[model samples]
Target: MVQFLNENGEFAVASKEHEIYAQFIRDLRESDFLKFYRDMARIRRFDNEATALQRQGQMGLWVPAVGQEGAQIGSGHAVGPNDNIFPSYREHGVAITHGVDLMSIIKMFRGVNHGGWNPYEKKFHLYAIVLGAQTLHAAGYAMGVNFEGKVATGNPEIDEAVITYFGDGATAEGDISEALLMAATTNAPLVFFCQNNQWAISSAVETQTKVPLYRRGEGFGVPGIRVDGNDVLACYAVTKKHMDDARNGLGPYLIEALTYRIGAHTTSDDPSKYRDAEQVAYWQARDPIIRFEKFLRSQGIGQDFFDEVQAAGDQLAAEIRETTFALPEPELELIFDHVYSEPHPLIEEQRAWLRGFEESLGGHTPTDDGENKVDYGGSR
Candidate 1:
């Protein structure tokens, strides 16, 4: 029982968790402890409120990050500004930590666009809905690093690494396997993170594999380690070490975070249909947000601080509400923009035809269901 951070905000890993790690935490400074607590609280607030917006119909659909805030926020803070991040769809916390606009995430859930921010701008890629696709992208990017001669240059400040996050279900995908193989062979500067939220759709972990998912990386010649995902300190410490290792040309590492989803898989999926009520109840007691808050209070933080944190959380929720309602619908012409750098003749021709049809109807095509259908004649 290595108690990394005690109930009171002090830094010390409990001896029960790991003998060596206890000493490691005793060496950690107070500033890092406070940062972990702050990041966890904010990420939790963002997800909790985002879910409410979904139910209120303020957004089309939302994937609640519910229980994994510790895992996300912890690892999110371990990177240098120069490092890159690749995330699967439920990584709103990482986006927030990276300074992505919360309102842009709202617009995505509202079905207004794919993503609101540019990957190049933040060095954080867009969320990949296709399971395990970003892992390959991460591996390829690492390969590019090798080509650029970034590996093992021995300058911790100058060299960089990559991190890709996927779920337990994705560990079973061919893309994940291929990515691991590529990274292992090339010794690419990458980190593979599997959140292991357990259930993949209606199927449970028993249905996926008997042994742990992190072990999958070991067979591929990449070292794998497990962390208590709900423990923000554990997540941060492990990821930070691995990231630093990668920066030092240690190649790749895989981390499997042991945690529960604590909510439905997404807005559209109903966990109640497949999971037992008692199981959900058991995990809810171990909620990451609540657990971390308790840890904070135990560290001598008073109700006043707690009250202030809650107030900040409330303000964040209200601000998102105001922002969501204020977003204007984008023009239809935006669909034709950004497809290509150079205009294609076919695209131009289609745009002209649509413009002519709209002008024929006096610049605005009526979408009234009751009106007779308008058939703009084309070439015979």
Candidate 2:
């Protein structure tokens, strides 16, 4: 695996093969390090707040990205302004890095909206709930970019690329396989980023695949690389290089980030039932945030900076909690909206049918008493 910072937060070349990736981080300034640390801390705070909101019944569900911050934030920053990002549901850190409002993600889980941000404006697509489906979408988009004569045009500013993020479990999806084939055949300017967080819900990644995920694309003619997902600098370097290569008209590349999921797969899962304490404790010791902090301290960053980040995180938590509580409940008809870009006759017919059904029910809303209320012809 490509790693610049080890578990001890010491920076050294992992191997000669990874030295190329290490070279990319040579020009990074202290300011960049600080920014990375700040974003990672803030996103963890956001993740914690969202989990709490779910527990309090404020959100319908929550997907925590606690341990994968380095992978998300580092690779998120590596994406150029013109590049498009198609994220799986757990990429809250990536969304924030692209300037997506945290409340938009909150509203999604609050059952208020279908990802409130505009993808065209931010170049960050809507979160994909269907596993690995976005890979095909990203492949198509990159192929479109290729056909438009945008790649390898000798103008970096005009070239465009596409990236899709998914998990280890998603690698088993046929959509990902088809996407790889299409990208390779068309030489699409795309990069496949996989955060192998070790568990597919309760299924271990080891049992899910026969080979390392990075090699999964090789048979399709798309080369792959493995990176230390917890090493923020390594992720940034490797992703920046691959993405830049993709934008420069190199065909699709795959990056498998080896990381761990520190929390349950979702708010509804009980990880303790499937995983042991020792495994969790082992990963906890290599916590990305704590490791990065150690690296920063070595560079003369003191307690004051750490304290400031903590204060900022606390303030962020408070602000998002307030925002989530203040969110307005979505109308019952919202499901009918955004089914299509423009109004369609079928949608209108279905919507009208729903409205008629609601009217026939006498506008009676469901109660929270946990009892099934059946409205008979003339009685309850």
Candidate 3:
């Protein structure tokens, strides 16, 4: 495995042979390390709180990103503000790093919004639930950037690159294959970031492919590298190099982050049925937050710093809980509002029919609390 910080939190000595990969971390400032620690810790706290909320029936479903924080936060920090990110549904850590409102994501799981935030404003695309679909979207967006003459502009601020996140399961989808072809043939400035998080809803990585996931990228004519995804330093170094290459008009690159899915696939999943307890314990020993915490302490960071971050995380959780409960459910009629930019006869006819049907069944009435209460039996 490619690792800079070992499991014991000690920095590994780099030989002359691996200097190219090691150089990405050689110039790190003290603040950079602290930021990485802070981001990872905050996301893990959010993940835990969200999972608890789901168990408490506050959310419809929740995807826990506990173990993979190193991969997501490291890669998230590597990209500049101009770069666009396309994320699969479980990229809450990456979203947090990009300054996405945590409540917006909470609202999504609460089933109040289709996507809770504006994508263009954050340079982070909405979460794509359909597997592997975002890869094609990312490729297309990157191609558009190329067509707009954003590449080779000699201006880092204007030269944009696209990064798409997916899991080991998504690699099996035809959309990912198509995306690879599109990116390779067009030479689009894109990066295919695959977090090979051990299990795709109980189907092990062994079942997905015979060879390593990164090797598949090589077959598609894009250079691929596998990194120790549990090590934030290694993930940061590798991703930073590839993202820079893509922005420089070097076409697409692939990174297979070898991490483990420490939690259930989602709140609805039961990993106990398929996976063994031993496997979970092994990965738990390699917890990214714990490892990163050790590294920070070794650098003279004290308990006070950690305590401050923990308190901040606690405040964020409280805010998310408050906002989630306050979010109002959208009315049935509002769904048709954004279906078309201009008036459409078909939409208008459907909306009218639905309204009339509701009226015939004794339309919803306002309750004492100002909520619309629909009576299934009859009109109030």
Candidate 4:
């Protein structure tokens, strides 16, 4: 794996030896570094809270991106405003980086909304629950951008790129392969970012592929590289380079981020059932947040700074919890609202039948205020 920072939280190279990757790091101000840390810390806090909410039955399901924060944050920060991002279900960090409202994400898991936020407004698509589905969407969008003569425009500001994120397990899906073929053949300005977090649910990476995931991209004629997904600096540098190349009309690229899935695949999963304790311990020792904190300390960042960030993360978690609880229960009629842009006769008829049935029930009816009223043999 390409690693700029080792597990010991020390740089593998001196400052002067940054070489080609220098452009990505050199221009970064202190605020940028702190922002990366803040983003990761805040998302992890939110992830923990969301998991708790799932256990308490607030959400139907929750996917935790616990250990892979570095990969998501670094790559997310690398993208420009002109770029679009298509994310799989677990990309909370990326969504947050792209200015997505955290409550909207929570609303999605709570089953109260179908992706509550508008994708166009943030240039970030709704999370795709189906494995590898968003890859196809991203490729199609990139192809459309090319068709519009947006590629090779010389002006970096005008040329756009597309980035789609998926996990290692998604690579086994036929949709991913087809997306790769489309991107390569069409030379679409796309970057396929695969966060190879070692495990696909309970299946290990060894079971999923005979060789490294990055190598698969090469067979499809797309240039691919592996990066230490736990090293934010490396992830940022590598993704920035490829994104820049893609925008310049050099075609698509693939990045296999070698990280670990520190938590259960979802709230319903039990990682302890399939994985050994030693493996978990090994990854826990290489925790991205811990390593990054060490680097910050080495750079003379004080304990006071870390404390302030902790407080901020705590505040964010509290606010998210409040907002999540405050979200109004989705009305039963909402399911019919977005089924079709233009109303269909069959749908309207079914909706009317349902409304009448509810009204027929003595204790159930629509109130004058337009809210549903339900009483179980009790006075209203």
Candidate 5:
């Protein structure tokens, strides 16, 4: 069923098997393919650097979206400027492509704030860390689009849609089930994109399901399809088509992207405890960034293009390291600022007390030990 992409990283149309992607790819030119290729490269570089920064004691924690770039970039392109995206924490690719400040994402890893930006203001929502909970918000948001007249206005340019991402482990949650039921019944203009990176933390895909996750959506009466989660082109083409479908009021579709999670679930995890060494080595050989770059070069993208993207990626990584390390630690007073938009009298009194306490301590300030410093201004 995953035959759309083979070991050689070549793609083709297999009848009724990846037909949607097969048809979609025929419409894309080499230039379109390069967009996905470039995104995958940049985000993977960012992921690696973030991991390094965390190990070097610069970040609070890091979530490596290393092998999941194809899933992230493919679905991300389906979104328009007016559309909204709800992402899981590992969606660095989606966030970066949507004009999210690179340093803003860095701040989250730097532990300066829960989320670095407002979702509505950015057109991309904050990353959801609650297992599979974003599905419901995505459904409600899609329903809101309908209520707001954002879908099917006889003008595709004005219409909007959503692509919500989760993982294989998230499928078991009631929120995911309820989201599917609501989307199926309401025909919400959303795409439920599952990046089945073959693991839910420590659990493997086989344990997560007896049948494929895409097929599960069929029970809800939505059209579901599987993609080569590593095949960036397939991911991009199928997702763009489905998002266009939602914008056209064709209703929700499910995409179960099949890929391997090459890194531990997060920096806190150790894959060697649960996964076989050979299995990890095999997927590493088939890494999405390397495979996509190979396909892009095969399609006539030059070594210069590769070199240019590589240079840009390296710069972005270094910038992430420097900027994240330099991000201001939240002012001691800011902890009380956003807690309530309208401050309570008691809260204000407590803030006053804390301020007085700081003043009494000689304006107690962190003295940088040359290695650790905190920046208060957001995402510098």
Candidate 6:
């Protein structure tokens, strides 16, 4: 695995094979490190707040990306402005690296919005709940980029690529294989990033695949590499190189980030049911945020900066909680509003059925003109 930082937060390149990846971060200033720390801390705080909200009956569900912050934030920052990102449900850190609002994610879990952000504006696509499905969407988009002569355009601003994020479990899905085949066959400008978070819900990653996941793409004609997902610097450098290569028309590539899922898969899951305390403790010691903090301290960062980050995180959590509590109950008609870009007979029929069903329940039904028509069971 490619690792630039050890568990003790010390700088130790793992091997000569990945030593070259370190050069990508050679020019990073102290400010860059501060930004990285700030973003990681922010996303982690958001995750904690979201989880609390879910437990308190404020949101329906929450996917915690606590342990995977290094992989998500590092790779997210590596992405270029013109690049496209297709994220799985647990990429809150990646969303932060882009311009995605934390409230948009909160709204999604609140069941009031379906990924409120605009993908075109931020280049960050909606969260994909289905396992491994975003790979195909990313492949298709990369092919479109190739067709439009976007890759290898010499102009850095015009050249583009696609990066799709999925977990270790998603590798077993056929959609991932099909996407790999498509990208390889077409030489699409895409990078497949798989965060091997050790567990797919209750099932450990060991049972999911026999071979190293990065090598899984080799048979499909796409080369692969494995990086120390817990090391932020390594993750950033590896993703940066591959994404840059993809933009230069190097075709599809796969990066397997070996990290751990410290929290439960989602708010609904219970990790204690399957995982033991010892394993959890082992990973906690290598917590990404804590390790990154060590590195920052070694660089002479003081307590004041840490204190400021803590204050900012606390303020953000408070704001998110307040906003979530104030979120209005969504209208019943919201489910049918964006089912399609254009009006369809089937959707119209479904809408009418819902309207009638609401009326039968002695409830007010929303009208097209934004008015609520109260049904009196024909008593009036």
User: Which one is best on lDDT?
Assistant: 6
User: Per-residue alpha-carbon lDDT of model 4 for 151-218, expressed as tens digits?
Assistant: 88998779999999999899999999999999999999999999999999899988878878988788
Query: What order do you get sorting by lDDT, best first?
Result: 6, 2, 4, 3, 5, 1
| Per-residue C-alpha lDDT of model 5 across residues 40-159, encoded as one tens digit per residue | 888888889988998988887888988888778877875777788988888888887798886777788778887859787878888888977999999999999888888889786789
TM-score of each: 0.89, 0.92, 0.92, 0.93, 0.91, 0.93
- lDDT string, candidate 2, 134-175, tens digits: 999999999999989999998988999999999999999999
Q: What C-alpha lDDT does candidate 5 achieve relative to the native structure?
A: 0.81
Tens-place lDDT digits, model 6, residues 317-362: 9999998889887887787888887766666667777877788897
User: What's the CA error at residue 158 for candidate 4, in Å?
Assistant: 1.1
Candidate 3: count of backbone clashes, pairs at least 3 residues apart or interchain: 0
RMSD of model 2, in Å? 6.1
State in Å the error of residue 112, model 5. 0.4
Over 1-380, each residue of candidate 1 has an lDDT whose tens digit, in order, gives 21354333345544454643344345557666666666667777888788888998888888888888878887888766768999999988777778877777788888888885788888889889999999999999989988898767877666889999999988888999899999999988899988988888788987877778878887789888788787777777777777877777888999988778887787888998999989888777766667777776776667886777778888888888888888888665555667767756555555556655775778744233333333344523
- TM-score, candidate 5, is 0.91
- For residues 301-324, could you state the per-residue lDDT of candidate 3 as single tens digits? 999999999899999788877877
Segments of candidate 1 deviating more than 4 angstroms: 1-28, 362-380
- lDDT score of residue 339 within candidate 5: 83
RMSD (CA, angstroms), candidate 6: 4.2
Q: List the residue pairs that clash in candidate 6.
A: none
